[model samples]
Target: MSDLHDLFLTCPKGLDGLLLEEAQALGLTEARAQVSAIRGKGDLETAYRLCLWSRLANRVLLVLSRFPVSNAEDLYLGVNAVSWSDHLEADGSLAVEFSGKGSGIDNTHFGALKVKDAIVDNLRAEFGKRPTVDKVNPDIRVHLHLDRGQAVLSLDLSGHSLHQRGYRLQQGAAPLKENLAAAVLIRAGWPKIAAEGGALSDPMCGVGTFLIEAGLIAADVAPNLKRERWGFSNWLGHVPAIWKKLIEEAQQRAEVGLAKTPLWIRGYEADPRLIQPARNNIERSGLAEWVKIYQGELATFEPRPDKGQKGLIICNPPYGERLGDEASLLYLYQHLGERLRQSCLGWSAGVFTGAPELGKRMGIRSHKQYAFFNGALPCKLIMLDVEPRQFVTGERGERSDAAPAQGAAVIEQARLSEGGQMFANRLQKNVKALGKWARKEKIECYRVYDADMPEYALAVDLYRDWAHVQEYAAPKSIDPEKAQIRLLDALAALPQALGIPTERIVIKRRERQTGKKQYERQSAEGRFMEVEEGGVKLLVNLTDYLDTGLFLDHRPIRMRIQREAAGKRFLNLFCYTATATVHAAKGDARSTTSVDLSKTYLDWARRNLSLNGLSDKQRLVQSDVMEWLREDRGEYDLVFIDPPTFSNSKRMEGVFDVQRDHVELIDLAMARLAKGGVLYFSNNFRKFELDEGLAARYQVEEISAQTLDQDFARNSKIHRAWRISVR
Candidate 1:
């Protein structure tokens, strides 16, 4: 074999260009960038250099042969043509890694098996003994790629991925990959910043991946310096002398780099449990003195004054793909933006996030944006100049002044806008009118505003002293930008009009939801506030869900249930959080049974019952309402059935469309009714129509108009209610 070898370096997707530059800088000839991999030529020493120093390459492969293969037989012949004894001993262990698909090779595992069989057969035919396969730890590791019937066979020079680096023995949840972290640093211009003796900090560093990588880059330390083994270690072409010389030279360079590198690197994590792992990783990387990890919250994180000013601030905050993450994360992103504006002025900022909209919520416009992939999810690496000028000149090219005059003028203008002022003035009038009615009725939670002005489409509800604002999804005919501007104006005027702190205002976008989306968790904040209405205390989480635990629109219905349930046994179906059950129990019902399929809501129902001093007589059942109705044998004098407009939950047997299945649902609940019993059926399906035939057999009165309270008078179609009894 010649000293020069064709090599293929694989890296994370979207980093091919960076890997190409690194490979060429390492003296690899004819380097060309490909999608997620780079093709180049390097000798034994060049390959060793990459294995030791390349921070962005996942694996460095030494290509041994290439041929056109059309079938499994052709693959076998192509692989068998290589002299197996020249690379691995006949009695040694080996493993084959197969990738891609081509003619007659669809399964990667089968292709790997065939490649293994060819190698073993060739070695056995030459030396009368075949190498045993070692899947865990092998003496020789081979890689085979099949693309459009062309095969490229290579040796896996790096035993494990170069990103492993033998440093991180402990990691936190979703720790950024080391190579990807390095790529982010490079894209953020960290190399130039470090060369100029600038500092770097990661506010939400998880297990110190970015901190350690940045430390290595700043200190000129080889990424794989501590790696004890490689695929070439036991290969027949292993050269100990050349490897030792390269190690010595890298050590000398690292020593000189560490001594004069005036760069400071620090990281902060809110999780105390992650601090030790970060310290352990930094210590193992021989950068303990350079990288410092502090257990602190983002709200309190600040750059160390001793480390100098105006370097780089980079973080990979939670992208929040899980349920209920986006709601709570909005405030976090807003806070991060404020912190940058206040404390990190003049510093460069890099924020890599999977949720780009959430990044936009930061309010700091990026000067440059790069696309990258974190696993399968495409993400953006946003770079911002965290200076006064950038902060003042926002994404809209508008000037934001720091003086109180400018702020007050902006607020005054928003409050005086033709549409905004009318909405604000109407809100004040409603507050005045409702204030008297609420005190007389002893209602602490009620709707204060419901799109009084059509241009400002929002529903503002007061929960005790707090305000919960739900913005209706705008129509496609309206300009979204204009709608957003009006929303901002409304938000600005709400606090002054309602006499509530801005922090007390919770906002959510309300669109038509189907299936189980409305019931799904929107945030994990678990923040709940206690509010009272009609002498009933209910728990409401304004920020953690689409709908607050208690339905404000159903206040009259619950009050009616309380008035009717003197001594009768009551049943509440689809009893979300059992707010009505609390009312029925408080109204002296004999016994109450609440049925729903969600265990979470059932637990919530139990809590609500407990909160109101209700008794064990009120039982919460977790079962599909349809199935429960089929098995129910107990008779009830009063029953309330309020089904969702639509539900396709996996726990349910089939889809439930209220419009299509209302008759069946009504019949099921009516079967459990006693003689002279009343069943109150209601739903929010706007287009609901009653079956005339059933109304003829049973007395059904449309009492929807009577159910509307003064607050919901404007939107009488919010829900429909009916009182049914046996004729």
Candidate 2:
């Protein structure tokens, strides 16, 4: 064998470019990037150095042979050609890992079995003893890749994955892998920050992954310095003297780096149980002098470094994946943003999160964003320059005065007239009461003031920061002059009471529309904003339509569908924007089909699906729901049909009046449901009632009380829903 060898270093997805850069820096020649891996030419010593210093690599493999393979026989012959004795002893243990699929073998388990059989057969013929199979702590780990009629074999030189640095034997519920944490730190510019003698802090640090990794980088200590076992330890081709020299050199560099002025690094964790574990990890990494851990709440978290210090504030906040998590996470991000603006002025910050939408609520603009993947979940690292320019001051929530460190903003409350004061007080009371329930249930869009007093007959809906106010058309008996005067008073008190900007309040007239007039385009401004519910993203435009595209009263219905849609087929009829189907698809539904008569809403539904990356296996049909139901033959496990109160569109064959046509629509939808399947029917008409005869035809239960969330509790007549099932 030649001194120069072919090597491949595997890494997590999105780190391929970083792995190539690190490999070349570690003396791997002619390095090239591949999918989640790097291939290069390196000598044995170079390979050893890379295994020791590579912070982003998962494993390093040394290629032994590449041969053409047509079928299983060719794979066996190709494996038998390599000299097994040169790598693994006959009495030693081995493991086989096979990837890719081609030729005859279509499954990875069968391919691995065939390769193992060939290796054992070859060893038994030569030494009269076959090696034992050891999946854990194997002496030799052989890997095979069969692709495009060819096979390449390699020996794993780093033993287990390099991400297991052995320092963190215990972690929190969700721990970032060591290699990925290091990659996040590097991308966040920790190396450059450390070189400038700056400090580092993680406010929500779990078990010190970021702190220990940052210390290792700053101290010039190899990430695998504490690892005692390696794949090459028992190999016959290993050189003891060359490995010893590399270890000595690494130790010297580490000692010199540690003896210098230590960098100020600290971690604050909310969980008291995690503080000790984080401290233990810091001590085990020999970074006790440079790092500290404190049990602190995020509300009171204030990192204190030496005076005249401006450094990086990096944190990996929890990106929860639950139905009721967005509302709480919105506040959490806002609190972090408030802290950054209040306490960490002139410092840089990086917030790594899988929930990028919540990150936008932080009220700061991240100048740079880098995409990465944590196993399969894609995430983004939002890098912020914590200067005056990065603080978010948009038209929705403009900061009128200098931001006060204590709370959200420092807006001077406007002086209210006698009537406006009462209106503001009433609005403030409703916000205080509803905000708590909103956070508890994760309700983003809600009705705040629904004409509590007859004098001010307007309904207000809060969608995140923007407020949608619809003035109810008054009876001619009430003076029109007084109604206008009250509206103007409410407008004057809105910005102060709600703590939002005047430009974000959308006012519209809510009159009784004559036929299909409600469906007409209200405006063309097209200012769409994204909102989250049940862990799915939805697009809503307040100024473009009469409705915001998401009905707050139907949130519970959508969440139930999201929870029950795994591996099931889902259908939506009269699907305005297909928001419920979006939730179902995100819940891992096998397939989704949405039917509607409006081509405009179908196009909007397409955008909603694509936004959440749920476009695969989702079908959108632009046809009237009744007509489509008659022609469609596909069966569905879950169906949702929420029709308008009345419609007389030119596109439809006939009029759709819920009071007159609901029974026929329900029967048509029930025909498409599979046995033991569910179909949810709802309508906004206050007096709408289900046909009494249909209950005898199918199992039906009224779920209106259960479907009404806290936001719509006051207005029980907003909508009514039913759960119909096949008997």
Candidate 3:
């Protein structure tokens, strides 16, 4: 292995550590795990070792060159400088993989083309024979990475992504990635647990990746030890003796099982199509006896008889995205939790999911939620401690009287079309139940429904602490206005029943439509009724919007502004009806300016201001807030800026996308602030990331607490709010 050279093995995120172990086992002594890849030094023999044995990696690339590259030209020049002739044969085929970050060059495919051109041009000029481009099954693969104006080029040593564990001759729908499964096991401390002879169970195993990987781990078998070939074997520099020595050591380790106990890995899945494929994979991995597969519903499946040692249970229950029926899915999770409590004790469990609401249905507070990426979906691996049956049971039985009757004929009747009659019944019952809980818990100003739309049919939401609500559309046609009325009625009655004054209640609605322009026909179907509660006037609109009149998610934000608004000058930009500005004014703001382009909304803002006992002394500007911020000389001590994610209209100077101009918008908004002013900037774009550097120009702290009210607390990323100050 003396002829070895520097190499880099890039794996998908979260698999770095596992890949590193495989590299070390293969005699790449210096393999070090980076954030998303591994780098080490090895000869061609070492490369071959990795190709045959790395289970938790995407590909392994051999380092070719590292140079400073500023733009496209710099990238081309750096690629051309590499000695391509030394590696490429006259008739060989090649492919270039390019990834870019923090540079002017944006298109990844275009960058790959430039590198390809450079390599072909360099080689063709030297030998009059250029390599053919082969994307699939290329003879040689080159990787080009441009990060922060610097480029690092390498040769791919692994032909296919390491996730193709070869044992997976058959696949199921959205089968778990091999590398991700391995990482999850590692993160769950599987090695330590397996060492104790703890039985392992995957109750919802789809394709048996977890069971197979766990079997391999228990038997001390490296994941990638059986790969047949590697790209580096064809490279000019090759070694044999030292590579064989490393393989000898690995085989020796495998000859000895980690323990003498019988293999205790088990998997269960109800899907008929997945059962055979799972068995096939296990058999191919030669773990047929060590691992067992069962095809049955979890309701009937029982754990294997307990051994002296306690075992571990892990599962990835189907989220609503892959499955449907929220109530059904929730019931599944709830039952799974019950089964764990009943059957498995002295054991730990890990449940991974992107849908938190579903996780909540499990009814057990996780000890820890490990963050990992399941493909592009952000997922959390929740660890639960299910101790022996002797713990916390035989105490509470017989459900509550206030628990709205479920699974009854009433539920079926409620699903039928009856002039919102069944909806009203369900909505009222949900509201009453929620109100009862809130009063018992002593919570006020809570949430009622997420959204009441035809699409979100009868999905009544309930909350006492934070606000989030929604109603999905029913299959059959119903009056959208009547749905809004039913929702508002529930919101209005909730606070009163919960011991909160009707005047203190605030109701909101959210629409998913593209708000590119105002509705061509603006007619008030039903006027909002203002009610009095606790000396404050409560404004509730049952039919004014696709929603009526409240943004429940911002309740926390409103409360925060009120708490911090004493004697401060307040400015509310893009003030849609200015409810927040009213909250600020009630907190006794020195002055408030509500700026917006819509005269109708401006009038509504004025009404909200007056409803809170404020007057024209509070500034109400009917001008474009963006232009106003750019030109206004007035200063404010507190600002509330919440813009649409995107908009196209002649009302403003140009098309606006919050993601594109966040830094500029923040900079300008801060310009009209007093010396020690603070601005609460918010956006509803789910994937919004703050411009940390720009935001850091001022003291910034996230204030998304209001956005995570009880109703919308299920997803923290739904909206993000941050406080920027000039302290």
Model 2 C-alpha lDDT per residue in residues 542-586, reported as the tens digit of each score: 887777788877889999999999999999999989999999999
Q: Superposing all C-alpha atoms, what RMSD in Å does each candidate have to the true structure? A: 4.7, 17.5, 18.6
Stretches of candidate 2 off by over 4 Å are 396-727
Best by TM-score: 1
Which regions in candidate 1 have their CA more than 4 angstroms from the true location?
259-262, 392-395, 399-441, 447-462, 465-528, 541-547, 567-571, 588-606, 616-637, 644-677
What is the lDDT of every predicted structure here? Answer: 0.86, 0.86, 0.69
- TM-score per prediction, in order, is 0.85, 0.62, 0.55
Better of 1 and 3 by TM-score: 1
Pairs clashing within candidate 2:
none
Query: What's the lDDT for candidate 1?
Result: 0.86
- Show pairs that collide, candidate 1: 324-522, 324-523
Model 1, residue 52: distance off in Å is: 0.4
Winner on lDDT (2 vs 3)? 2
lDDT of each residue in 429-473, candidate 1, tens digit only: 999998898888888888988987888889999988988888888
